[model samples]
Target: MVPFRSRVRCGASSLNMLKIAGAVVVLAGAAVFSQQVQAQAFPSHPIRMVVAYAPGGATDIVGRMLAQEMSADLGQTVVLENRAGGGTLVGTDSVRRSPADGYTLLFGTNAFVITPLLHDKPTYDPVKDFQPVSLTTVQSLGILVTPKLNLRTVQDLIAYAKANPGKVNFASSGNGSAQHLAGEAFRTAAKIEMVHVPYKGTGPAMTDLLAGRVDVMFSSLVGNTEHVNEGRLNLVATTGAKRNPATPNVPTVAESGLPGYEAGTWQAVLAPAGTPAPVVERLNAAIAKAAKSPRIVETLAAQGMEVRTSSPDALRDMLKKDSGEYQVLLKHTKTTLQ
Candidate 1:
């Protein structure tokens, strides 16, 4: 048996250990509680949303609209910052390097998934570097041809392209833009060869297309609506799987001739990877609410955008799926950035 003094020391040591353990538990619980509180009170400050394109563009316009509505829903200001360059690489890399505190977000587009595939070396990984918050909208592209081309439908365009081969040229917003990808997809699906004429932006590309400098273009419906309505541009087929509500008379590429041929632009909100789950959830909820707002819905509809929101997981899955699809499409089309 131990002596009384030894027994007392052992008891005290055990008691001290218990106290330390208890304190550790309490501290850990406090830390967790503090984190919970912080997450709950997220956006305690203004959030900066990075638009990966220049101002006065579709992404910027849609991002601003969504930011305004989300600010109201989140009870905090969401500022827009344009960091356009490298085909959205500059802004995307900026967001990738930002703190995952939910204060910085990226207004990502289909380019987010396609740009990396176009480049031989990319600065960031879309799926790994960013946490998807929500998908904002999907904008369909109209297959516009110069009326002088006499391409009445997608079939007519395909037949003419097959007959003409490399003689048929299509204009795109840029070399690796969604417009370019859509044209490439069309080329692959239709099994035809067409020259790709890349311009600085949609304005220039549309100008060339309207001037009959280019025979065809896969352009945003919003941008070509007026031209199509005025008969300056012919709407051969839309790039969406279904007819756009704004132009129900226009059939989709799938409905026209090429089945499973759907290509269009999309915009989604994403936070840097490693953002807190609660913060992501909060932002997603705000986005969902904003997407459902009557004014937002109406405004997006007017711009030829269909408002569509998805959960974080859904958005992540979408990015992965789209990335894979783009890889295959790019490979098949042999599309490389110049």
Candidate 2:
């Protein structure tokens, strides 16, 4: 038989444990309720989207357009702010540290994964720190040749590069950029040797290409469409499975010579990780609606971008797929950023 004093002490401890368990259950319920309430009341104020690119650039322009569309859909002001620097690390890392609320978002691109993969020690983990809302744009790059080259098709460029070996120069906005990687991919597929000329941005690189300083470039047609229309630059081949609607006459690099070859950059919206599921769902639906808006569709289409909105899960999968593909290219090409 236990002593009466000891029995009393054990009974009291049991009671306290039960009390603590009851309190824990109550607190958990309260947390769930609070989260639901918060998610329901999301977007009660204006939202901010951080664009990790230079102001007045192609990404900025498209972000502004989508922001307006999202505003219409969410019935709240969606503001786009440019926060460019450190190869887009500055803006992106800031977003990762932001609250996991729907109010602040990151205008993410392929660089989101590619940039971190390039660094020896990444500041943040994209997959672990961010929640993808939706994929908004998928633009295929176009191959532009300077008028001095007189390269009419992908074949012509390949033939010339093969004959001249290391004489043909390919211009890119920067090292490890979509343009640079695409050029590397082309080099691999075509089995040709060409010198790579990397510039700080597309503006200067395109300037050089136009002045006959560089022979060719694999870039987008967003701001360069006018140059192509005016015959200042020769748009030879587009890097997509299908010809871009903006340049239907131009053939894809795959069809021209290298089959099963496609390379381009993409843009999407991402929230900080740990955001509420309901809030993520709401944002995804709104983005889908906004990207399909007639004005947004027309504007991006004219610039050679395809409006390809995707669900949150799909976007996550795309991030993984693109990461693998770009990793392969980086290894094969041995590209180093300056």
Candidate 3:
């Protein structure tokens, strides 16, 4: 038999535990209610979209366009901030640390996933750290070579690379970018040896490629079509299963000699995890609406980007799919990066 005083103390202790549990439940309910209220009051101020690349790169160009359109639709200014470096890690990771409000967002590409996988200690987990808003667009990459190389066709480039071996140099936006993997795929498929030169971003890499400082780059044709028109860059092939409408004359890399070779990347918007569900829905709706706009569709089409908007869940599935695909590519090519 327990003492009467001991029983009383145990009863009081149980009562205190119940009080603590009740307080926790109340706090959780309050948090959920606050999120709902915040979502209702969202866009009361300017929202910022961080582009993880240089100003002139495809990601930045497309990001600015989407921001402009989404701003008009959301009745709030969507400011773009470029934070490029470490193969897109610097800017992308910065957004991961931002508050879980919809005010701060990330305009990211496939590189967003690939960049983290390259590091031994990844800065963030794509699945755990972000809430994907929606995919903005998709585009095929161009296998561009400097005209100074005098390479007019994929075959010519292959022959030159085979003959020159390690003397052939390939450039990419950064160490683990889609461009980097595409170049590696080309080298493997063509059975050639080419040194990789990585830049801080595609803009800097394009600058060097234009000046003949680099021999080749697998890049977007967004803002560089005039260079090819003026004979400054030779776009020998594209990396798409089908011919890109923007450059129908350019054959796919598979048709150019490397059979069964295809690679491309998509662009999407993401917010830090724990963003309000209502805010995510609002963002997805704006993206879907903007993607259907005639001006936005035409402009993206001109740049070779297919205007393909998706739900947040669809975008999340894409993230997982690309993560698996890139993992295979990285392993097959034996690609490593710091």
Best by lDDT: 3
Model 3 segments more than 4 A misplaced? 1-28
1 or 3, greater by TM-score: 3
User: How much is 136 displaced in model 3, in angstroms?
Assistant: 0.8
**lDDT tens per residue, model 1, 240-307:** 87888888888999998789988889889999999988899899999999999898788668657799
Candidate 1 Cα misplacement greater than 4 A, ranges: 1-31, 148-150, 159-164, 198-204, 207-215, 302-304
- lDDT by candidate, in order shown: 0.85, 0.85, 0.89
**Candidate with more favorable, higher lDDT: 2 or 3:** 3
Q: Which ten residues in a row have the lowest lDDT in candidate 1?
A: 52-61
Q: Which ten residues in a row have the lowest lDDT in candidate 3?
A: 296-305
Which pairs, if any, clash in model 2?
none
Taking every candidate in turn, the Cα RMSD to the unseen true structure, in Å, is 3.6, 2.6, 2.3
lDDT of 2 by residue, 1-338 (tens): 56998999999999999999999999999988988898788889999999876665456678898999899989899999877666678788888888998889998777788777678875777777899899998889999999888888999999999999999989875555678889988998899998888765566677788899999999878878988999999988999989998989989999997998998888899999999898999999898898878888887788899889898889889888888988887898776675
Query: Which stretch of 10 consecutive residues in model 2 shows the poorest summed lDDT?
Result: 52-61
Quote each prediction's TM-score: 0.83, 0.88, 0.92
Query: Candidate 3: which pairs clash?
Result: none
